[model samples]
Target: MRRADEKDDDHVTELVSRAEQALDELIKDIEALVRLESPSSDLDALRRSADLVTEIGTRYLGVGPERIEIDGRPHLAWRLGDGPRRVIVLAHHDTVWPVGSWGDDPWSLVDGVIRGPGCFDMITGILQAMLGIRLLVEDGVDVDGLTLLVTADEEIGSPTSRALIESEAQGCTAAFVLEASGPGGALKTERKGTSNYFVNVVGRAAHAGLEPEKGVNAGVELAHQVLAINTLGDPDLGTTVTPTVLSAGTTTNTVPAKARISVDVRVRTIDEQQRVDEDFGRLHAVLPGAVLEVEGGPNRPPLQASASQDLFARAQELAAAAGLDALESIAVGGASDGNFTAGVGIPTLDGLGAVGGGAHADDEHVIVDRIPGRTALLAILIKDQLSA
Candidate 1:
């Protein structure tokens, strides 16, 4: 294999060394960040996570409060290596786990696993990107335009942070999302298009025990709609539709007057996005008495990496040079902030954080052993991008 040129060789070696030395501090910072439990709906917790990130940014990242913003939301931005070809790291500090959903204390490193609410969804990602950048700078990789855009609402579709990600991404040439990598080791190059849909069934309520014929039975109608949604799923193409959230009925005796369902959808291609939309529309026809509403249509768009996305290829080379295994970039079923950046026509990579399983579950955790190596890969990726 050909070695990196003189500049590339020295920078890669130096960044790997610095990242190795910084791993302990990175893990500690990640543990503290996970303590905040920044669920997407909890503005306070998300903001607090952002604050914790910014504080760590100040102490270790060498950026001041002026570079940080925390009014209704928390954010941090920095410039590394001057020029037009800029690079940005965009990630959210939020998770799907709700408050009180986990154990009494959700933060701990048990047997090399950092177990917590937001540890897997992305607080760990923030730590990786933040600390990675710090190591990059400390290793003599002078970054004049290395910007980090850490936002609050990625787990719940990034309603508030989407605009910021797009705008920040526009200012850079490429972006990296701090989402967790594959189970062991890999980079995510593509993610399914997403849509969050809702269907409401409206009917007349009557006592099930007394006047059963007088009721329209919204709950029964909802079942029909749910079946229609299930038909949209095609396992062969990675497209899925699940009416995962349902709400209806007030009492056992009375027929449900109103029912609501929220669906989680994933599609492989842009064309399939339209198919999902058409299938969602069929929900209205399923129950004449029901009303349906659709929301959140493909917020991230597919990552869809081609050879044109040279950034991903460059990242692989850099990772290998840092003494890590060659990264196999693959498509993922989950979404990330990288989706937003890529939607805006920028080459983006996701899953650059800790390696672990159980995201959005009570058992969510980060594999402790993978932190340093992943951090090393990130540092090298940044250095390689700046100089590539």
Candidate 2:
């Protein structure tokens, strides 16, 4: 075992050189994953994607992941090394792009850029992790107490994998999320917690052309609720309460008797999340004869900076040791499975994924040149943790 402080520069350079040598194979693995279109909504696609991931993981790590299925969706888990301390490498295989959205040719490599569905959003991160582990094993570094969990549903908010993530994160020393990097590849130290709500209104129906006054309008009640909900946002504290989707009415001749409002809530702190939850629970219908029903609260808790500060500091040290550019950390509004781990009181660091731009957009891509250095950095981070 190599100590982190002993011959640190040589160790960093050697790992980086090994990663560079494996760059071609890394790109090949990434292409294999990108070729498979695994949209979050498609179970069949997810299954195929899981199979491909299992194969690639086995080929690289010399071991297959255990397939943990939830609600017919397959999630992959690998428990490597059997040490006293445990850490998790959290990633997801699902992409936002639907099937056929990327057209016939989903894979492309041009001008040292690889473009495809799920390439930047996190496919490369998965591959990079595998390569990092492979490098660690080849160099005789102990990877015991490491768990790599590649979940199947993330693009749609990890409906099936949240509990599993929380369970796996318990008592772990650190969680490294393989989500896409922020602008300029900054590590994500903080992420706002998210909540989803559906406000339903029920009212009596009546003829719009005749006695519209007799009708208790659900649409009117929904409008009132939307206005009320909009007031809950605190811009100074970075809390946003947005009513995104709305629906009401039965026919053109009748007053709207049923309505629904989909609310999206984001908060930077648990206090704010609790405040919003209480505010939402107090919502009431202004119109007479309208009953309101609110469902769904706090999906993922905030990934607080406290959960990542130590890991971020250590990562900076590793980067410096590797002779790489200084690492930067950012707080993003987006949430990931990292939120679940962090919420469970685990130290979590995020955005240690592919360096690229335009995630979830048509031009989603990965910078081909950054792969080796990033992979090497990840390996070094993991080795440091294992050594400790």
Clashes of each: 8, 1
Candidate 1 lDDT (Cα, 0 to 1): 0.73
lDDT of 2 by residue, 54-84 (tens): 9999998999999999998999999896665
Candidate 1 lDDT trough over 10 residues, lowest sum: 64-73
| Tens digit per residue, CA lDDT, model 1, 233-273 | 88887888888989989998998988888888887777787
Compared to the true structure, candidate 2 yields what TM-score? 0.97
In model 2, state the lDDT of residue 123. 98
Q: Which whole-number lDDT from 0 to 100 does residue 227 have in model 2?
A: 96
Show the colliding residue pairs in model 2. Answer: 81-144
* Cα RMSD for candidates in order: 3.2, 1.8
